[model samples]
Target chain A: MVTESDTGSIQVEIIPSRFLLPATAQKLLNEIYGNGGIIRIMIHGPNLPRSVPYGPGRGSPIDENRDLLIEVGGQAFELSVKVGRIRLELESEKYYEGLKAACERALPISFQIRRGKFFHTRQTITDYAKYGKVEDTRILGLIDPKAKQDRLAILSEENVAVHDEER
Target chain B: MAYTPQYYPGSTSVGINRRKHMSGNLEKLRDIPEADVVAVMGHRAPGADYSSTHPPLKEMGEPDCPIRQIVAPTAGAAAGDRVRYSQWTDSMYFAPSIPYWRSYWGAINCKGCDPGTLSGRQIIEARERDIEAYTKAQYDSEMTDVALCSMRGCTVHGHSLRLEENGMQFDMLARTEMGSDGNVYAVKDQVGIPLDRKINLGKPMSEAEAKKRTTIFRVDGIPMCGKVGARKYDEAVDALHHMWELRSKWGFRPE
Candidate 1:
């Protein structure tokens, strides 16, 4: 979800457990911010809570989906993504391939992919101001940069073994 | 260290590894007039404490540039040998504590001779001074800040008519001179390239004395020592206008 404050401040949250995959969340973030600004990602799980900030500078506490606030030129922006089965409030927007490239730059591979699947696979994103919306929904699938080549190969290789399973 | 391969299109590597070949190319650049801007470049020599880093080169033309390059002597180069350098090492490199090798490029400056006879150092310095004066004249007249384009064709915003405040700043007030002819002529004194702004003269010039008549025009308020051509004043005016527009867009301080 994206929310803009009165002071030109912005807040975005993406929960992976609530989505099909992390890639879904990534796709949504990429669609909003084109470029010209920096994006920082903080990963928090079972054990790592309020841990040290990743990357260059030191001395900071960050938690998972708690809130990572970024301020630029006196304005603030925050992003938090929740995990596990979620009913996306916004309509699922069609995923763009370039979105994958953008995600690769910001969040790590694992979280980015999970977010992408969760958001793009299940939600419905609509233009509130304009009813004539852009259709961006795509087939249910996972697009992970790290697993792209291997996953495509696995899918193409006559999946005779998995076909035998009777669910 | 292992010998790395160096590649140059249609050019022989002189059978040396990448490091040596790079040094050779850098040497050749020192000789090219266009490459005179490369005052320093080199690979880190083995065990030679090569931690120094040269900052990105400033685009050539600007008024009152923090960086200046003249064919100045290197610590090792002979008195006649010249190298390009900034006015201050600290402003050029983010960190200047580390030691590094040096190189020189560009023309030399020689005073005393008429403007037309100048080619090497004298010509380069004259051009720089003339350009600076031109910008200053415009600033003084328009009462605004102007942009100064570097010799490298990069434009820097922020140049003003007001004198800069430095404890030891010299006065370079603008003035007008009238000679035998009755018309008033504007003139400015020349400022030498700073100690850090040194570049070596790439090619030697024939020191021939030519019988040439020259005129002078003041640019901005800075005094320039040069023989002005028929259209030199117009050219100076155009340069100032271009810089003026640029500085305005870049939010330069007029002060």
Candidate 2:
């Protein structure tokens, strides 16, 4: 807060309040993380499969192209985007408001935003614990993207490095 | 007694198209060369011999039956050409030749043909040369829009999917690709095997042209409910309703 400056000149301030759709969000993310590595963006919506399910060409391969090969910040990132509901396990409630708003701008229907306990705030009795899981279901994917146990393996599998540079 | 044939009922553009398709009155849109049609069918090379499944009926010397004597075999059967099929997939986005409509066209127009209709695709199986001729007729007719309808024997995925930016229907196997010269080129056969050279199928129909020619009663287009003679209370619907009611009532009666 710029309360009282020594010069006491007419102080001007700017606030970033523009709502972002998927296209705009993509640009914003690219600009913010342009210098290096990867800023994780988990896109959730209508999960369209990359293959045909029925008819004469049943089980035939298709290029759904939902798995986007986006070249952001001059670095190509293959975002394995899925469409679904997200249960936020956020430390701050304010961040959840922004996440909900972002979802609204993209998908206006079939999405419910509510405060709930879902993903673990603290890692314990994990789906896939330090070594491995007792029963790792295939539906949840072979490796959970959120799990910390196979953090390094997940990064390598997705071909992305953690964005750890100072702002 | 002489009989008059009325194809389909309705005063709407869509109904009119259905009538045109069924009556074999669809205007010729393009003339794909016989060689090009063969190339797309991928059954046999252009000018190649038509492989046979059996000897010609005359050569085999069939047993003298009154029925066989009266019913002359088609040219294809007479030549002993093997039975072959042509399958087509029409996109739901105002494609002219819907599955059922395609089958109707083939069943009524093509002789010695067996038409099978699926949800998104339709196939017509006949003697090899006969099928090729039938397929070529459909390809050249207004029933097929190069972008909206495609000959896809298998792996047909674009029936309900969004069209590509170039206005071509989505082909999972990339059977067709749009050329820089504004012509749609078929690079692969119906089953998706790469061809030796591209077959230029010509330009896609304009949005206006497709909407006018489409037989599909879409909400944005000439919806069936809003059409002048095809409305719910229209004679076509009323006739169908009356027939259904009578059929059910008569089922329980001896008369």
Candidate 3:
């Protein structure tokens, strides 16, 4: 019942929930980059809850904030997260290795990772109607407004760097 | 001559695991320090002298009874230690131990033990020291995985609930937490009281290890009736059937 035109490139995060915290993800990224390597981190998970449903804390706000401050190697990078998979395609083999290690550490042991095309690699009609522009890369198809506003700045490897030593 | 005892039947991994638990012969996988176990139990503080309800049995002269003289009391009973309990909730998602099996394990292996089996949780009541020892055995043995099982006196959710996105069971009272180092740390007692410091419970089981050690038979993992010899050779089922057929004919007055 599904058609190709209706689909877009997307990612599936098969890992458990605890590892998606910005701080924890940053720690994992730091570990991979610590050993003379350059890599980009892609985070994938369920949609962050927007509200608290019941009890004395009923209707309280959940993780509604789309922006997070990710700290890796003492450096702080402001990342605007969407409700879906955040992909990383970079210029080094270490990036893949780091991504694998981080995922293994973060996800449950029973989950599996598959290699394939998941996200829309091309701009859609929606993008043209909404943004009045076509994205050059396929990774940014179904992103949040904040992520779009940032214009791929958050995904830039230049945003990641070790913090100044004198902290 | 004594006959060899067989604990359970079926060639499936779940059946084997059940036998190992009933037999009390599974190897201990990790060591949670004694004080840590005590802290989590919340009956008494670590190193605190057990509060007694009665004087020592030796000090309190007892009326002569033949059964009392013939059978020995457990260490806690002997010491006149107060009765205490440690309750555990196991995630049905491939947890190494389940409620009914835990009850069976305690009844067969522990002295002066009274194990309560519920739908989602198991509770064992024994004299202070005896229950502590039994609790430690369950915690350290292959029966428990830090992420899949938790000590909860109340608010024992996550049994049927899908594992928290991290595959860990978060005790409702916030008794346990997954540490940044990826190990489980118990910061609260079983009853939701906070401890002075956290106790490290150690690493969780791998997926393969958990599947092999689990007693829960599932279609995705190892189906209960799907195994080669399980349906045909299940000794427990056979025994139950034999009892059931006779019971229908004989009623309660088997004699």
Question: Which candidate's lDDT is highest?
Answer: 3
* Candidate 1 lDDT, B26-83, residue by residue in tens: 2121122222222211111213432222321332233454433454323222222222
DockQ of each: 0.00, 0.08, 0.05
lDDT (10s digit) by residue, model 3, range B1-255: 998567776667788899999989989899989999998998888899998889999999999999999989988998999999999999888999999999989999998899999999999999999999999999999999998999888666658755554567634344577888989888767766667898899989887889989999777898765455543655545665787898887756645
Give model 3's DockQ, 2 decimals. Answer: 0.05
Candidate 2 Cα errors over 4 Å, as ranges: A1-69, A77-167, B1-3, B228-232, B246-250
Best by DockQ: 2
Predictions ranked by TM-score, top down?
2, 3, 1
Query: Per model, how many backbone clashes are there?
Result: 81, 2, 10
**What C-alpha lDDT do the candidate models reach, one value each?**
0.24, 0.66, 0.69
Clashes of 1: 81
Better of 2 and 3 by lDDT: 3
Cα lDDT tens digits, model 2, B1-255, are 898577777677888888889999889989999999998888888899999999998899999899988988889999999999999999888888788999999999989999998888899999999999999999999999998889987776678765654567766666787799989898777876667898999988998999888888887887764464632643445556778999889859565
Docking class of 1: incorrect
On lDDT, the stronger of 1 and 2 is 2
Task: Report how far off residue B149 is in candidate 3 (Å).
Answer: 0.8
